[model samples]
Target: MSLSPMTSVVVAASLAIASGAADAADYRNNPFTLTYDGAITQNLPGRVNIHPVTYKLNGLDISANVYTPPNYDPKKTYAAIVIAHPNGGVKEQTAGLYAQRLAEQGYITLAADAAYQGASGGLPRYVDKPSNRVEDIHGMADYISSYAGVDKARLGLLGICGGGGYSLKAAQTDKRFKAVATLSMFNSGRVRRNGFMDSQLSSVQARLQQASEARAQEAAGGKVLYANDVVLTDEQIAKLPFEMYRQGFEYYGKTHMHPNASAKYTLSSLLDLMSFDATNQIELINQPLLMIAGSKADSLYMSEDAFSKATGTKDKELFKIDGATHIETYWLPKYVNTAVAKLTQFYARTL
Candidate 1:
């Protein structure tokens, strides 16, 4: 395995133990147990709390959480946004946080667990194909556009981290979304093929061979191989490189982990991920666009590249959160608040 990915395994294992090992199911009921300061723990006095829901997507059952606005009246129309979770995330993590916050702003929001991952129903679980992930975003929009009290014409979309990349790809063809926004977008294709910052360029052919072999094994009725599932010590995790990987382990693998989210994907997924590029046709997004990233985030390049290539949208802007890294923007209040404020304004104006 590449050092960039192997080191991340060390970080996840170490932090999972450090965050107080327990039954993963026990963490779901109270998602805010390790949430950032001021995180809403229950339904706001007048707002609707998360409504655990299930919908059909491509013949599979997809689980999701819908947060309705305060004093929500089904008879009155309201804007809606479909929020997609990060690659290793679920509806109960950062995606849920942003969904709830957007609901508070009077927009009905839906965050769903992608098909084949999290609580969704799919065979050979944890497949991470770009086509499937992008379809998941389109499915979210389809489900939310017809939801009670939603104004289909004013629908919007928000994607974080890996989801941000998928969201861009989805919005490229799904023009139903009036506005599109992404936070700390991480191009899964670029990194999966070239390695983080292209560090694994030399090993591309070798890794592709590995992935092909894995796919063949699965096709032969063999057990599925997984990636990003490793065990390590706290001391080891602390010494790993990359703040995003380090702190990300703490967020998803540790404090905020959910039972349905294991942070691992089928090793064979590398085949599709390596071949897909979210920015390949980004100019198709003619709707208003807002891409936000932390100034210090190493993943900022993906967002910048996507923003520069988005020639179809004249009303596009790139905002940066000063001094914040990618993972820090996931839960840290200072940066989360800034992102939410900008998103609120952007959606209000465009959607």
Candidate 2:
């Protein structure tokens, strides 16, 4: 039964529409679905278990996954770690993977969705306000301290990508986090203001111009549009200046794509990011700090720059994973293992 090309196109379009509707319904009801590729179940020993938990923080119901260590006793308090996800990422992404792995290593780990994103609550979804995001970290620490089986005094923090920057900001004021670590930490403010590697310094005025237009549109009752770096086709992806952008899509857009994950962010809120600087208060942090970044990453300079600006002495360490790119450290075994090992040692020593 050979159909005409137009007929084939119509059939394909119909199927896509139906599939999209079904997905939308599922998302509206459940918000998230865990795709068990047996990565965790098969690899983790039978003793460890990951539990999905929800708690309220700052008038919002926050969703997170908590991994309990094997042979856990309620009477015995255990050290805990709070894992924050990358920008445009939910808890179930790399954060969840790291949390599960750390739980297998005998530490209780909690991976949380940032406010206004993923399963967490906020109005005008996907707003990436720096202060609110930093508060989310502190909120997670509060949740950890309230747990009966968790020791509040031995709390540690781990953040990936933008979350890494937020973790550093949180640790500045929240001394409850005895140790802090970041994986491929991104200084969102620096990149927003000066661009990655400072290559877009001259384009700052242009970006501000675009943002002003976006604001004008919003004022005129227009829905805000988002500009995402995700490239769908080879031609579109070829336009990326570096290989890391293409690699990031592989990790976040394809292999581990979540229905709740969004590629775009509100254009108007971008101005907030440009003005937000997390590194300004690094001098206030007195806890042990670990900053992990890939030497080959285009974003590596941000982490290095932050580490240099941090006034914390004696306990701060910067580890560069040789030959790895920024996005490669997200889920790659070699990079993930290196990060887990470094983080485990850092927390073990400090907490």
Candidate 3:
């Protein structure tokens, strides 16, 4: 059984599980490489400034961008938010947009590339295991909390797409995040193990066998195996069954394409992703929680399941953006405005 087809759509949908600014100026002028609308062209005074930063996480260098609010003064205390990008997504896309937007609202925000993906340093690249993803969220919290002007006690978190799943896991016990929220929350493990909507349930055991073989090969110094590495044409994308994947490709492939964002992962990663479930121990996340998703999103079930099981947080709320889809929440300005307004209110009241 080839590992390709099993995860081709699985990872692509996970890509659905999931910014910027520079033009004309040299890369250094806007090293952040944000791609969202109204991105910071230059760090003018009294305006949000993007800071490109790198930090060590578990012996690997992690790349991140920190956005400071207008007229930011390190001497004064401020609430900070840690934004986690979606699976196969880098910090420079929607994550950066949210970071910049949150910063404009007088909050400092940090968005980082996952350790083995994006611009972050890691070997045997594109390894997308559940543990590593959860750790990335924790690492972001660690780095952002120590930043100047960040009031550690007032920290909040916003995770997008697959990042939302990992964020739920991270916030399960990392109470440092006083408030937690997710937009277009995607359960990467659920979709990866069951194949988007459970359409591949019959092939679960077969795929597991292939993943085991891939792991054995990797351990024996054989060539590394990968999946979902194909680039799709316009006709191919339109043929995709789910609106999430159809629009996701357009967002990540063309309209908001970035070199660091990819839809592939190490095939052996299935060994770890299969047994994982984002909702496991979700009751442990006692922090105030807010989950937002498009009312029409094909991935809405994932958010609904996780939200219903979060009984530990009496303060939790599930918000749906009317007329929006999973990928639509990522870039549509109208949907983004509604989501941001709700987030701003939630964080302000909780943090």
Candidate 4:
């Protein structure tokens, strides 16, 4: 639970439950379990079905989950949305929760893992390049737009945490997305360059030096060195600096644990992340935009800053969930419901 920004493989930790999700004993050793609360337990009678899928993105296999509504009819076209997981997350966690919920609301949804992370195929696992992550979003849009029962012209986009930030960038030019929404968006570049809350401004040069050396080592065929690569004890987890990072451990490392989910990215990734900004040309997103974040979230500034730069969208809004922290908006029942409610309304009206 180090808030070092490396553990940014974050998610809404799944809708924070189905009946058996409240009891850990039911799934303690179940490898097939989705690991997140309210996970699909045998595809309920009237619920959506999650179809695990894979497609090529920049010559790599990208893993994804496609959610289709109950009694889905392929003959009839339907609106769709692409849900992007946080930087350190996969399709089965928060991204899946939102996709399933949206599908329940009559929209086909696709959630995919960025290449090199989760179950996706890529070299040097966890590279986390900005261009690659953005390409993942475009790839999702490409696949989902052509999916059965989906209307190519009525597609929407949603990203949670780090994915949120990337979605803004993608929607800027990918006019296929008629509407764009983000929940707890995390600005990967801003945090990487300026540090958490800009607390490490003075040490930026030193960190860059470290990253450069790490790249040199990699070039020399040395073992990969990762940032925030530490195993924490229970007490140590309890002592983490931010609630977002602390609760992230409880979600990804314990309750919502999945074999493919991880927070570690290559140290070389900083070179690209530090230079990329999701809002660099945000004004290009002329589509309807909605940015949601917990009012009490420490990462609220990222959402606010991005929202402010989106002047191109006349139909834009910044909504905050009062009293909820950054991570709470991920899985807390009330918070998740609030976010899903807003998203449903936004997509319904726009798409």
Candidate 5:
């Protein structure tokens, strides 16, 4: 007997889930499930603590981790930062690392899995629309602002990779984010519309047609289609042309792999992503801005472009980490330290 295509997809999805559960079991003893270096293994009294939390966002449960500074006192006020993870990334990866580091700097930091992408709640998982991503940031701000000891007026936002793009868009009108920052910003809309480095410029229309069809199929209750669903071999990953993507595989798929982290998204998401622009109406953001990128990153253009267009803020600055590639800033001690230091200063001054 032969399996139908839908059966094959369902079986594959089941296997992926089982594999993820097995991988996650390795960290079952560790409550936080954090995979970053120097992560807190236990929440000790009188020290920075990781608090697992869940809140409602658009009728879905949003899972997040709140890192509170050492000796945190709810009676006293403190600034807060909402850290948004990269596309396909969960709160347990680099986002958690940054949130922990910022917590160590005496600020409360919250990192949540994007709804539908990580451990958060949503139907038809891996839907990656820009509007949804932007709302994730706003929802974070809303939740963290009410957190004990957080000063609602001093809230800040930090977005990494694709999260950076959504953060920019979120801060454009949210206004509650007094300061906005991005690390190795990736404009999902731009890449989705024109392809990486505009390599697929000729196929924009073709891709749109496919996305339209995918949406139609979903509306008709057809089996959902996914993009970037297959895992790649190491050889294939190494052959990837862009350094950002090449090292991204090592970071996301190997060394820093997490059960919730993935690369797949609903194919119909392109219908929304293709027309979305992170920098559109960017001038509406009057808050302080800081954009950081690796000097050698191929994705540096995205940060630079957004920085230049952020004309609404006179206090904006673009900082580059010398010699660091896009993914290197995520985990490399030296680069991460430098980026965190600059971020600490920027938040101290602006938040």
Candidate 6:
């Protein structure tokens, strides 16, 4: 494939699973085979149009999926929302679920593949560079603003997991987004620096050392290795760090898995996430912000901490779902509905 300079090539290669791979053979040839079960699926009365488009960002061609509301009219502008998927996720992941739901609510939504991951463009696939990730959100905003039915003045962002943190970072610099929201937001840098729940702070230096070695190996023409906390086997799932990690596999590895989804990521990218900090500029985000997380989730603390640091006083709200876990918010009906309602209300009010 001849890639445009504006698109990062890394994303195209990483997000695509090899043909005949055991993990996603069914989805490779049939992208639409994955059926989504949600309120949007049941309630949407008009034809839901899914568009495959590309935009230039950071000198790379970034791919995206745009969902237009039923009865959409090019002459009439409507509120727009940009959705960013979780780490190692594509636009077809849970993001599409959220985008389709939001679109059914009369909003035009764009779900984009993050640079270096999914269908976006980047080098050394699955390399999660914080700066590039933030830029990718801005790129989506740029693309959405130009669409015929989109109201650029009323732009909002919805990011899941790592995408949430990047959304925060993007909103800090790009005032174009009038409202912002994040679900199960993961502070990639914090998790990398201190480990989950700050349990591995003592080993941070050692991890950095190993990452340095990995970088050296890559520079020496060695293939980079990818590491994911989730393990697929029954025995590995039994030893997972948290029940949520095992559950995440069920969502990302099997039932909801897309052919483009990958459990692997470039080892060198860990170095970037280890030092990246999105909360540092939370105060700069003057727009209305809604941060959602499960009260019992191990990742909830990061969202809480971010809400505390955010300077947008009256415009910011945090909702902690009582009995839910991190992965539960991804597709669980009860939690996903609550999140969608909150997000719709937040954007409707602020955007």
TM-score of 6: 0.87
List TM-score per model, in order: 0.92, 0.86, 0.94, 0.91, 0.92, 0.87
Off by over 4 Å in 2: 1-38, 41-46, 216-221, 229-231
Find the 10 residues in a row with the least total lDDT in model 1.
9-18
Query: Number of clashes in every candidate structure?
Result: 0, 0, 8, 3, 0, 10
Model 2 Cα lDDT, one tens digit per residue, 1-351 = 232211111111000011112221132333335422323442244576777788988888898888888887768899999998887788877788788778877788899888888888887677777888899999889887877589998998998888999898999989899989999898777766665566566667777667678778988998875545223464544455566666655555455667677655666666788788779878888888899999898788878888998887568999998888988787777887888887778887888
Ranking by lDDT: 3, 5, 1, 4, 6, 2
Model 5 CA deviation exceeding 4 Å by range: 1-29
The candidate with the higher TM-score, 3 or 4, is 3
Candidate lDDT scores, in order, read 0.81, 0.73, 0.86, 0.80, 0.84, 0.75
Q: How many backbone clashes does candidate 6 have?
A: 10
Worst 10 residues of 3 by lDDT: 17-26
Encode model 1's per-residue lDDT on 168-281: one tens digit a residue.
999999999899999999888888887666666777787788789889999999989876666545665566666777777667666666667666778798889989998999
**Candidate 3: where are CA atoms >4 Å away?**
1-11, 14-31
Cα RMSD for predicted model 3? 3.3
- State the displacement of the C-alpha of residue 120, model 1, in Å, after optimal TM-score superposition: 0.7
Instruction: For model 4, give the RMSD to the true fold.
Output: 4.1
As a TM-score, model 1 comes out at 0.92
Model 2: how far residue 248 lies from native, Å: 0.6
TM-score of model 2 relative to the true fold? 0.86
lDDT digits (tens) for residues 1-351 of candidate 4: 433334432211221111112233123543334555766766655679888888998899998888899888889999999999986777777788888889989999998889998899998998988889888999999999889999999999999999998899899899998999999998888877776676667666766777788889999999887765556666765675567777777666666666677777788888788788889999999999999999999889999999989999899999999899887786788998999999989988999
Best by lDDT: 3
Tens-digit lDDT track for model 5 on 1-351? 232222112111111211222232233445687877788888898899999999999999999999999999999999999999988788988899999999999999999999997899998999989999999999999999999999999999999989999999999999999999999898889887876676666777877887899999999999898876766566655566677776776666566777787777888988999899899999998999999999998889889999999999899999999999988888899999999999999999997
